[model samples]
Target: MFNVELTSERIARERLETRRKREAERQERIFKEKVRTIGVDVKALDMQVEEKKARKGAYVLLKADAEDRRYNFEACVHQNRQKKKSREMEKALVNYRHQHQMPSTRREFDLNDPDCYRKLDPGDAQMMLPGLAGEEQDSKSRLKRQKEQLREWLLCQQKELRQGKLRKKRVIKGMMAHSSMPWTWCLVCVPARTGESPPRACNRSFSSRSTRSRRRR
Candidate 1:
């Protein structure tokens, strides 16, 4: 009876050992599966972050390009304004000198008149001078600059209008070319497909003769 009890106890211990090993194996498999899932999640999150950064970078570049274009346009407008103002000032100087130095054709005035600079107000002459400071002077300069800009803008507008005419001519020429025989001539374009025999070439002379006859009429 002791031997039988010992055998039964040994068998029970073996079954418990097997159950423990199976449970351990199941826990290991679950841990490995969790690790794999976490790794995939991390990779996906990294990809999403990289894509967001790329999009942000692209947005920044596009904004910078637009700002640069606007800056260039503004600079062009400013330079054009200064050039116009300088021209107007030069013209005014010339007219004032001509009136003072040369005798008028309609009325006889002394060519060597000493009152040439006297006719203009002290403030006006000072404003025309290189450097001066006052609120009124600042206002005048701003007005003058604006007037100069207006003239510059007008000249630019005129130039653009003239160029538009040239552009129209070019478009008309292009239209004529498109409507004419060379553009109208149909090309027998046959793409050679893979694993297929190419189509036979058509007679070029016969096709050209037909086109020529149509054009002549």
Candidate 2:
């Protein structure tokens, strides 16, 4: 009976010591600097930060991909538009050529036509003689009209020449009247026209005036 009691007491003491050691270890872990600083799971927070960064990187990649796709779509649309415009221009050119460039409508078509001689009118031969007579008459009338035009042109030129001469005479008369000079003054000044020298009296008057002006100065 004594041995049984001793064994039971020893076992109870060992269980109490193990409970205190476990409590001490739990308190040490709870109060450690790494756990006490934030009072939360550090590894869990780090994993959350990593996950956030990965999500942001993925979003950036998606945005870049979307932008590239949009650019490609717009470029494709522009290329298609250019092709359509080119096709339209070619179509318009073809239509214009078809409408205005027919072979039968060309000026040289008659030369190439095999039936040109057969298509000639029967009356064209008979009209040829009269046409020659009419052409002769037309030539005579044209010559007469040309002669009349030449006469009129000559008369107009002569009248213009006479009017020009009269204008020159009037200008000379005006100059003489404005200067209060006589025809002798004109003849003296215009030696090329009259081939004469100035008179003695005119020379004397001009010398006297020059002397008076020099004395005044």
Candidate 3:
């Protein structure tokens, strides 16, 4: 009877050990499944982060390029403006020099001529000073005098043409000088140069005359 009791206890202990091993295996399987699921989610999240970083880097590169292009455009425009201004200044300088330096007449002096600077003989004396020739002199003397005067006038005109500066003269206030050009030319140009209207004194005289005529009538 004792033997039978011992055998029954050993059987019961073996069944209990088997049940504990099965329970441990089931718990381990559940833990491993949960860990695998968490690893998959982490990998997907890492992919999303890397993609966002790549997009941000691309945007930064594009923005830098745009700024570079804008800077280049502004620099190009400034250079063009400076170039145009320089060209205009150069043109104006050329025009100013041309107008001042050029002679009006085609006549030129020959410095190499032997007779150009010789002492005055009778013919040269006649050319230099013709009024010295007497009134009793014949038509030849008169013609020589006229020719000398014409040469002097031409010389003055030539001097006026090159290195054109107004002659320094003492100013005489309250004095009217004669103009070489016609009065009609002066009448047209005076208003334009001096920015003045025609003489109001003449207008006043005319108005006074008109009023007097009306009273007489």
Highest lDDT model number? 2
* Candidate scoring better on lDDT of 2 and 3: 2
- 1 against 3, candidate with superior lDDT: 1
Highest-TM-score candidate: 2
lDDT of 3 by residue, 10-127 (tens): 9999999999999888778767765334335777889999999999999999999999999999999999999999999999999987887554322563444456557447665644
**What are the Cα lDDT values of the candidates?**
0.70, 0.74, 0.63
Reference-based TM-score of each model: 0.29, 0.36, 0.31
Instruction: List, residue by residue over 1-217, the lDDT tens digit for candidate 2.
Output: 5545688899999999999999998887778866544457789999999999999999999999999999999999999999999999999999998999877789999999887767888766343455544456577889999999999999999999997677657655754565543323433343332234445565424343454469799
Which window of 10 residues has the lowest lDDT sum in candidate 2? 186-195
Screening candidate 1 with a backbone cut-off below 3 angstroms (N, C-alpha, C), the clashing residue pairs are none
- In angstroms, the error of model 1 at 138 is 67
lDDT (10s digit) by residue, model 1, range 97-129: 898766554354555556857876877785454
